[model samples]
Every structure is written in C-alpha cells, then in structure tokens.
Target chain A: MPTIVVDVMPKAELLDPQGKAVTGALNRLSSSRESGSGISEVRIGKRFELTVEGPVTEELRERVREIAADILSNSVIEDVVNIDFGDDAS
Target chain B: MTFRIGVVTFPGSLDERDAQRAIRLAGAEAVELWHGEHDLKGVDAIVLPGGFSYGDYLRAGAIAAVSPIMSEVIDAAGTGMPVLGICNGFQMLVEAHLLPGGLIRNAHQQFIRRDQGLRVENADTAWTNEFATGDEIIIPLKNGDGGYIADAETLKRVEGEGRVAFRYTGLNPNGSLNDIAGLTNERGNVVGLMPHPEHAVEAGFGPDTEVAMRSGVDGLRFFTSALRALAAV
Candidate 1:
C-alpha cells in the first residue's frame, strides 16, 4: 500500500473567533477555576495531519482534497488543503 | 551549588532563548540542549520551551516527544528532576506520556497573542515553590495548538492530588476541562504550563501591569523556585 501524508491549516482568509475566545478564556479559567488563577489556552489555528494508503497519484490527491473540503474542513469558514502528495505532494 | 538549567533546542523551537534568559535571570546557569542529542550534560533542571517543533508537522510535538534527549529528560523527571514545558513544550510532555492529557488546536482556529493571567493554585511544585498559594500573575501567551484535553478520571485525580497548579480564571481558552492552566506530577517535580513566564521576566518587556505593562518581574520566580527546590535536596 502506498502511503501519503497531508497537513492543513485554518485557511488564512477566515477569521477565527474561537482562537480569540480561547485565549481570553485561558486567562479567566486560570483564576476562576481556582479559588485564584486565570491563565487560558494559548491562541492557535486548527490543523490536521492525515495518513492514507492507496495509489500515490495526483488523482488520489484530488479525491482526498474533495473529501477534506466536503467533510473534514468547512470551506465556508475555514480554508482547507494547503498541501498535497501523490507525485509531488510533499 | 548553583543551579544548572538545560533548555532543549528542538528544531523550530521559538522560545528557547527566552527560557535561557529566564534561567539566567533566576540566577541559574543556562545550558543549551539539542533535541537530537542524547546527553543531558548533568543539568539540574530541564525546560521545553514553546514553538513549532518540526513545524508542527506531526501532531504538534508528537515526533519531538520521542527525541533522543527525552530518554534522559524522562529519566531525570522520574527521579524528581525539575522538568518544565511551555506551550509546545507542554504538548511534548503530554505526547511523551510524562504528563496526562492531550493538546488540541484552538477551537476557533486562529493564532492568538495576548497578555494572559494565571493563578498559582499549587505552589508546592519545584517550579512554583516561590509563589504563594493564591498569587495571580500575568504573562505573554501565543500559539495555535493550545487546547488541553483529558478524561474525567485524570482530571479528578489531578484535583485530588493538588496537581493542578495554575488555572484559567476568567475564561476557558481552548475548551480545557476544569480550566487547568498548568500541572505537575505527583512528586511535584515536573511542571507544564501554556503561558510564557520567561517572556515576563524583565521589566518593560514582560506582561502589562496596572501602572505599566511588563514593569513587574514576578514571573522570574518560576525559575528561582525550581532552583530552590533542587537546592533543598
């Protein structure tokens, strides 16, 4: 079985309010949870790393992209598919 | 004896320098440690600073958790050496199974930068010995993979044992359950927090204060606390 890997980011174009909310939340939770702390989770975009085994070809790459956009990544708010691998997909 | 702190330099680690500076500010000798190197050079404590190790290529610090140097770091931590991991470093500590839980991406999907606050809940850990039981402090925070996730049992045990060090006060940044900001092992030797305390060490460069941002250097206490713990032994 041929193996391929794909990495993605939160399409730079979309605004990620979740990131903002969390950053702020980390600070609050830090103190609120405590009888005193308020540090929150650091802000960062979403990403996924997937490994699939099949034909390592351009056609397969395109098919994977379609699946990601349709299901894995929401194109309406998130930009998906910044990488590919099948012949030059690295 | 003067404390020797080793700062690991994993490929793509952005905050190692800041950690090193924090070490020096705390009166400890800072040692540069390579992620690929297996030898630890006998440092008293180790720090895994934040940043994209291997460009977050394989699950944020996933690949890095298995680096050669971890063998020593893990062994040391097991033997009660002070091991502190920042943002990416905290991710690595989890991936290595040194600590519990996992770090996921921000649910919002954006890179966030802010002056964050944290309460010192467990001041008994080696890295936090200098802090009071209820002290609150602010530090700079930035990252893209900061969500902290764990099962209910683990969270309960952590609370029972007082392993939950710092907690988020006002908000829940990454949907982390129980609002945990930092944690320590049962022995209280290892610590992993999401904020960058090192960045808040020097005045005019750290977090903002009521009078002026970054004018206070309370964050330096983290490093000093670690050194103090090792010395007490």
Candidate 2:
C-alpha cells in the first residue's frame, strides 16, 4: 500500500489569524533570548493522508490531483501546496 | 396552494429548526431535507441553515458541500430554484460553487455575535424581494469565520453586475471586503449571507428595536420574499 499526502494552506495574500497568533507567540518567546529573534511569520495549514491498497498509477495520481484541487483545497481561500507520495511507491 | 420550502440539516447544523419555524410563520410548509439523502422532497425553495457543519473540518462547509443532497441541490439551482444560505450555510454555498467568493476567519480573530445592521444592495433576489434597494435592516449575526474575500476580478464583476445582495452598515463586523454581507447569483435565484435571519424572524425572540426589545421581525421577510418569488412563478 502506498500513502499519498496532500498539503493545503490558506492563500498567501489573505490574512491568517491563526498563523499570526503563533508568530506573535514565537516572537515573544524569542525576544527573551539573545540571537533567537529571527522568527517572522507562520501560516497554518492541513495535511491529508490517503492510503491506496494497490499500486500508485498515473490514473490514480490524476484522480488524487482532482480531489486535492476540488475537495481537499478550496481555490477561493486556500491552495493545494503539495502532493507527496511516500517512498513505498515503486 | 401552499408553498413548500426545504431546510437542510447537515451533521452539526444548529439552525434548521429555526429556519423551519420561520418558513411556517411565513405561511409556507417547511420540509426537512437531510444531507445524506438525494431527494429534496419537491421543495419550491431550499435553505441551508447555520451551524458548524462537519465541525468546520477542512474548512467550514467543505465536507458537507459535496454531500449526497447537494447533487440534487446543484441541479435544482441550475434550473432556477431559489436557495438561501445563512451563516455557515453561506460557507457551504460558496464551497458548493453555487455562489462566488469565500468566507475566511474573522480579521480580528474572534467569534462575533451581534445585531448587525445591513443595507439591501440588491432587492431583486429571491430571498430579498421584500426589501427595496437600500433598505436598512438589522439581523443577528454570529460567526467566527465570516470575513468574505474574493479575487480582484471577481469583486469587480460582482460589483459591476450588482450581485451583492447585502452590505454591512453602521459597522463592518467581520472585515468583509467592500462591506459585503450577502450575495446573489446573476439570475437572483440563489442567495447567501453570513447573518442569522432565522434568529430574527420572530418578534419577541429577535433583535431589540427602538420600539421594543426583541421585536425586530425584519428577518421574516426573507421567507416571505421566497413566497413572493414562488407566487410570481
């Protein structure tokens, strides 16, 4: 079995409040230490792991791409950042 | 003849009953539509009520948009069937591609609940026919991800075509672009808004107005507008 991973993130132009909050927290922690204040921003996203029982064919890859674009990520506010097939895929 | 409107209840939907009650109060028969079913029960209009459908996983209304019933809903909407999406329902409508743009987390990063004032931008839609263009009304709005966004081109088109159904007035509560609070498709058959009009349909249970507390029944006209749209058909 091969596992396909899909990563989805909010669009770059949009404001990510969750990411901003994390960034703020990181900055606060880094400011207390010398030479650790380089963190600037963070954008949170989602990762979906899909397991297929059989060989990973091009057809399956295409189908996964469609799913990623249409279902896994909403084009209006998010993007399909990456699709990775694990090392098991021959 | 009695008009039949269907209210869809996706898993985690919280406002279907109130929507049904609003429909009944508007002198229309309210039918319950399920997310996992393919039938719409021959409804004249459909409403996707507010709630955290699928617990807002993978984006609000994402999973529920492709549910079994939405296939029927998509087809029916194509044939000009009237559909109203309120609050989280608005998210589903955008996810389903029945309406344009998308709602994102509030700019202030907080859940907002308030009696929101809105100006009717387009009064020709099925759910807004009872209002005149520029009519101001107050509806209770509550949501975490209610900020509306779109590409610059889409915004231009939506504005040029006058598809914006409602605009926030007095104050923009969620930082929605251009103060857009609601929208309608080109044919005016579909409408989606982030406010909970169903919550404001009843006089004693709605927003407080100058005359009395919880006496604003402005939301009732949304259902009545549907009735009027159906009656004229």
lDDT of 2 by residue, B180-214 (tens): 99999999999999998998888899998888999
Query: Per-candidate TM vs. native?
Result: 0.74, 0.96
10 residues in a row with least lDDT, candidate 2 chain B: B166-175
Q: Write the per-residue lDDT of candidate 1 for residues B161-211, one digit (tens) a residue.
A: 898889877776765667788888889998998888899899988888887
Q: Give the residue spans of candidate 1 off by over 4 A.
A: A1-90
Task: Itemize residue pairs with steric clashes in candidate 2.
Answer: none
lDDT of 2 by residue, A1-90 (tens): 788999999999988888988898898888879877687889999999999999888898899999999999999889999899775442
Docking quality level of the chain pair in candidate 2: high
Interface C-alpha RMSD, model 1? 9.4
User: Which candidate gets the maximum DockQ versus the true structure?
Assistant: 2
Candidate 2: stretches off by over 4 Å: A33-36, A87-90
Model 1's CAPRI class? incorrect
